[model samples]
Target: MRPSDRVTLEDVARAAGVSRATASRVVRGDTGVTAKKTKAVQAAVASLGYIPNSAARALVSRRTGTVAVVIPEPDQMIFSDPFLTQTVQEISRDLDEADIQLVMVFGDQSGHGRRAAKYLRNGSVDGAIVISHHRFSGQVEAIMSVQIPVVFIGRPVAQASPNSWVDLDNVSAGRLAAERLLECGARRPAIITGSLDMVAAHDRLRGFREVLGRVGIDPVLLEGAFTAESGRAAGEALAPRIESGEIDGVFASSDLMALAALEAWRDRGLRVPDDVRLVSCDNGPEAAAANPPLTSVDNPTDILGRAATDMLRAILDETWDGQPVLVPARLLVRQSC
Candidate 1:
């Protein structure tokens, strides 16, 4: 084809000596094709410089070949968190590998999530992969109202019937943290929790408390907003107790919060692992950057992202059987513990 001339699937089919249907199937990356025909179509495509028309393909296939990765947080919060960035990047890569496009949507508290839900409902994309949707976000309701498939990166706080989710087993993570603290002989342990509105926070706390309860120990629980400020406040609140030999270990729900806790302890002249051992979740970059490298739970967030995308793809392809998938979490020990 000459410059400014578009190469069509018909031209590719003719060049490969195959029917247009076969050429289209190859272009769509469908299965059940003979190796011989596949090679011929690919070779013809390379020789003819054929670039598939996305609009025309969508019209013929009734699929937009795109998916959305929705984060129900403000743009700043979404971008600032390293975990979210990683999740988006991994999801994009996985979708791209499947010959699909990724559309990122930052769903702010100010109705941005609902707007995104509307866009999804309008057939703008095939499916969506939503992350960190809280009970109060109202995005869940909007998502449930839409016909398109949605796969959540983390378990949504509220249940919308017949939804698919891919998440690390938060309950297992909590249980493991509790076991580690116990094994380390940490008495009078406490927890600085993430936002209670999030299901993850609830699951982790439940598992932590359940394990502690079995040992006849009740942990001191403090509410936190999953922010450094909240972590600092909780740390300050517990500092007095820690100093008096009352609380000796802590599990903060996030690495950022754990780092802030370290700061509060330092201000009070308390040293980590020496004075009070610590473990946290979401083993992000901050875990290693702390003065003493923090022990944290690796939630396999990238795997969660990949699983969510794959689930959405299956649903879009009418192959998913409506089962939820849970990836595992593990503890990475460091000086903080």
Candidate 2:
């Protein structure tokens, strides 16, 4: 029998009828394994649902007096995204308290993960904090090669992602947004989701779907790249549907997206809460500053950032008990809905 979230490499090896070393070689992308054994290992992994543990990859106890904060995004995004900046700031503030230096690494577009991986493999830092990892970016493989104490700001979209992380209850946040829309007596509701490559975005979408499904409202789903440009694009796309009365309410994935939707609707001469209603996630200053004031789900970034740092520090100190922290998100209702 296979265990969930605790499947070990050794178990996979035994199930595959190969030596543990051989299984390790395959998992690490070693090309030395024979074709017959490689097929067996693949079948075993799929049947048993084996999840690779990053913490077990040649974990070495070392102190480098520094920690790396890796953001897998371009410089322009680093400068514009308040969420990313706040995450780094909270981590930096916490690290400064313990006299640890923070080295910011930008793992940007195409092949940047490899460069980031190369720097990390040099054993230059005691630990690392990874944020905004995407699917197929190869960032997961890159970070796993380091063997340092690493923590993720959000769970990566990979089966081999490290288990340790502190994050908001995004499902609850999505449900809060959907509930707010329904409470306002909206007849036709829709959702604008963030990039599905991130686990938080998927969780938020799932929660929204679950809540709306229970009430017989099949929401119109729109995807966004978690950027202002994408948000504006989504808003423009929704304008036509709003005019046809096909979408009378919206659950935007972020405050920025919600504000963009407000602008789009206003430009179309539609009044919020009268012609359409809007609720958003990531309650921030912009939400409060909107013309009608947006109702939003608050995923406290400060709590998540500090909690992740605290978990990383505990891992560094050998005092961690291996429990994950899940901070609940709350809705801040305003006039927009």
Candidate 3:
């Protein structure tokens, strides 16, 4: 092959003294090809430096072998949020095992949503898995219009309804967190929630409120943007009340925020659990590492990722009838609550 030129499958087939079909079968690991012929094709493929064109293979197979994972969070938040990172990690690992390529797209900021729409419309991928669709831009509308297979990571907003999705039992997670605190003899509980626009946050809060209300405790609620900064700010704002002994227990929607709340309490010279108990969601690494380890709701991101990939594969195979998959969440109790 020329130094600057790309090698083609035809060259490999010719070098191997085999038909292109035989070479393709060997490359795809199909059983029909004889072992001797497979060895010859692989040797030729190596000698000619023949790299299969994924796009071309996709065209012939009617499979892109590419899945796009869209996160509608800003670039900074996408990197900082443990849940998003862990979920994507699991998705990538699962897709890698299936020899599928994973494409990551960030739709958190303003113009990126439009870019995501254009990319999906271009038909460069077989399907998409959407996460964190709190913002209601034209992006969700664009994704829905593409007429391709889509599996959402969480329950998408109303605009993207009638679409298949995989999500943890967020309501149960919330109730579990609340119950943990209440079982510990917590009377005055405060909540720091994610943006109310997001379904996960809404469901989590709803579950928590239901449990607390049944027990005759009016929970104090605060809204945070699912960031450590927002959590810290909420904590600082609530410190006065906390100091006054008005709030005895606290639950932040996410572990990242919950950790910040822990620090905020420390800054106010208050001890964890001893002075004020705390709990949060997304039982990620940070929760375990937090001082006076944080009790949290486990969302099982890895399981969710694998399930979403399976759903997309089913859709690709025409086996899915557009059904939603619900994964249950569990509670991880620690010293913080």
Candidate with top lDDT is: 3
Model 1 spans > 4 angstroms off: 1-5, 108-113, 157-159
Query: Which scores better on lDDT, 2 or 3?
Result: 3
Highest TM-score model number = 1
The estimated TM-scores of all candidates read 0.93, 0.79, 0.84
Ten contiguous residues with the weakest lDDT in model 2: 54-63
Question: lDDT of each prediction vs. the true structure?
Answer: 0.85, 0.83, 0.87
Model 1 per-residue lDDT tens digits across residues 1-337: 5778888899999999999999989988899889999999999999988998988878888998888888877676687667788888898888888888888877666673677777788877888888888777566877766788888877775545455988888998888888888888897999999889888888999989999999899999998877778999999999999999999999998887888889999999999999998999988877977889988999776788788888988887799988999878799988888
- What is the C-alpha lDDT profile of model 2 across 240-333, one tens digit per residue? 9888998999988888777877887788898898888999888877788888998989867788789888999889877888887888889999
Model 3 per-residue lDDT tens digits across residues 195-218 = 887889999999999999997988
TM-score of 2: 0.79
Instruction: Tell me each candidate's RMSD, in Å, in order.
Output: 2.0, 16.1, 3.9
Candidate 2 error regions (>4 Å): 1-62
Cα lDDT for residue 98, model 2? 76
For candidate 1, which ten residues in a row score worst on lDDT? 154-163
C-alpha positional error of residue 238 in candidate 1 after TM-score superposition, expressed in Å: 1.1
Candidate 3 residue 269 C-alpha distance from true site, Å: 0.8
